[model samples]
Target: MSQMTLEKRFGQSTVFVASTLMENGGVPESATPESLLKEAIHVISCGYEDKTDWGNEIGWIYGSVTEDILTGFKMHARGWRSIYCMPKRPAFKGSAPINLSDRLNQVLRWALGSVEILLSRHCPIWYGYSGRLKWLERFAYINTTIYPITAIPLLAYCTLPAVCLLTGKFIIPQISNIASIWFISLFLSIFATGILEMRWSGVGIDEWWRNEQFWVIGGVSAHLFAVFQGLLKVLAGIDTNFTVTSKASDEDGDFTELYMFKWTTLLIPPTTLLIINLVGVVAGISYAINSGYQSWGPLFGKLFFAFWVIIHLYPFLKGLMGRQNRTPTIVVVWAVLLASIFSLLWVRVDPFTTKVTGPDVTQCGINC
Candidate 1:
């Protein structure tokens, strides 16, 4: 292919270029323009035959969108190893997406890449079994790929409270004392894990909470979409375009990027989630009041779940609002439109209404 390309472009001159470079010792400083071009072509063609790996594996691997990770994993699978170095001062610095849209798109790209790997032949779950890759390292890679799948359960969990509020019923079965003890133990373990992570990593409490908040926001939005997008590519052979993340502009005023808004479909899920949870809280509380419930247990339980969803998506809500003191008029209108439509649907459906059965149909009025 390289020879064909060179012939097509340079035709008979390719021979002269190679001959010149041979005499020039392949050094650009000592070589003519034609010789320099030949030197580049030699490296591109792997003519020197570097003994590190095969020609294809000379640089980054290319199957997945995240070629860097794929390359590293392949190296490790082949018995190669890497070291960790943490300098007291920073070794390098990089820019980040300062705005919500860019950040979400960046996350979407990464999640999509992970999904690509998860569904591919090189998926760490079942791949590299015959290789030198250790079990723990393989497990870490598996975790990286499968993390996006968590969005499925997360979305269900987030929407559960809303569904329960709207339908006036809980789908979860009543648990016995043993189940309650198990639940308490699980909660305590999770709490202990978080505390240990904070202490060991030197991460502040607020930072840990922020990480949790962003995890939900991305899980429901970007990761959820990535799973579907990846399925489309893998199952249906439809391709997704890779988009480069936009970086913060130095020309902008301080933190201006944070207030900048760009429309993306990724925003819709989280926005809807925020609205639904808020509605659930309001409707559940209103129902509790109207029914004059002697026990506040169920109401509080539903409210806790609803509020949990809302709190997780609060950052997303703020991003939609942008720099305005109030939410933008467009967002307000959109929210109101959704609320109105859902309200009409709820009235029509009335899922929780009890059926009285009335009189027998055989002895009914003239209409029957």
Candidate 2:
């Protein structure tokens, strides 16, 4: 089905470069008119000469990392249908980043680019040309364009629990109840579905789990950083350069911790989050002990949240502790700054004074 869609929509025959076809004997000289030759040259050099031209029918375009998806969105907005082809064996294979820092930088650039496209006049959702696009096509492009926006909420969720713990507050309900059960079930269902989707896409369980960890770490840190840079470009009229990821290979297959000074800033957010979570867990446990474990319910929630943060922080922690070179000096500075800020908040800001109460917990039995 996908092959047929690819053939019907984006078959190579539909895109004709007169010079190439003539040189390769794909199209005969007799068939190539002089006017068509001119148009072909124009299309090759600059994109779509006219919106109504044959070149406009081309559904997808591949260029630089940042421009590729933007081009696809533009074409789709112009009512051309396209599909991504992920073959078992790639049609083209290239070097991939072997280290987390490089990978995060690559995603940051993509996020910034996608955000730019989303906010542009050519945004798929609000563009005049978008009227011709089908609802699903428009939705797909919308999803692609706004994907980086998730970083905002994701960052909040990742840090909120630690903040609450520091302030001696519980955001989650205390007693196990119907609503909590429902929430737990929903979370499990979503997680299971994600695992299934990854498995179906030929990802191993370990790889999928590692990818999720990266998602949390990178999504909150690098993605949010990209959003900030992207906003400066879009709203402040600043120009940002596109970043290319390093494709350096590791000599051994095992993970190696190397100090990439350029990306040390990217480590700040995750490192700060790790420190906060560690502090929160230790403080929460001490507080619980002092309270005769009466605060076990809230303590449990804090511990669970800390556990989740630790899972995502595992790689970063490993890198930090591995060797002197593995831990960047800038990261330590950032961590210390964050710790001081958190300490001030804990002492003077008084987050606990204006405590936000949780949902009313209803007692429930095992069957209920």
Task: Give the count of colliding residue pairs in each prediction.
Answer: 0, 0
Give residue 143's error in model 1 in angstroms: 0.6
TM-score of each: 0.78, 0.75
lDDT of 1: 0.77
Q: Pairing residues by index, what is the TM-score of model 2?
A: 0.75
Q: How far is candidate 1 from the true structure (C-alpha RMSD, Å)?
A: 9.0
lDDT of 2: 0.71
Candidate 1 per-residue C-alpha lDDT over 1-368 given as tens digits, one digit per residue, 9 for 90 to 100: 46555443333344433543354323334457776577557656634434333334536688787777788888889776677767889889878998887898999988999999999999998888899999888988889889999999998898778877776776466899999999999999999999998998889999999999999999998999999999999999999997899887678666877776776777767776677778877777888888887636777877778888888888777667646654445656565576557655765777767767666767887766
lDDT by residue (tens digit), candidate 2, 1-368: 35444334433333343333343335544555775676556546643433333444543444324677767666666655555679778788676776767777888888887787777776777874524677777788788888888989988787777777777877665656888889999999999899789878888889988888888888877789888887897789887776567675556444442444345478888888888888888888888888886798768877897788788879877766765576667788888798769756775776557667654446444434
Mark the regions of model 1 whose C-alpha exceeds 4 Å error after superposition.
Answer: 1-55, 325-368
- Screening candidate 2 with a backbone cut-off below 3 angstroms (N, C-alpha, C), the clashing residue pairs are none
Q: Over all chains combined, what TM-score does candidate 1 have?
A: 0.78
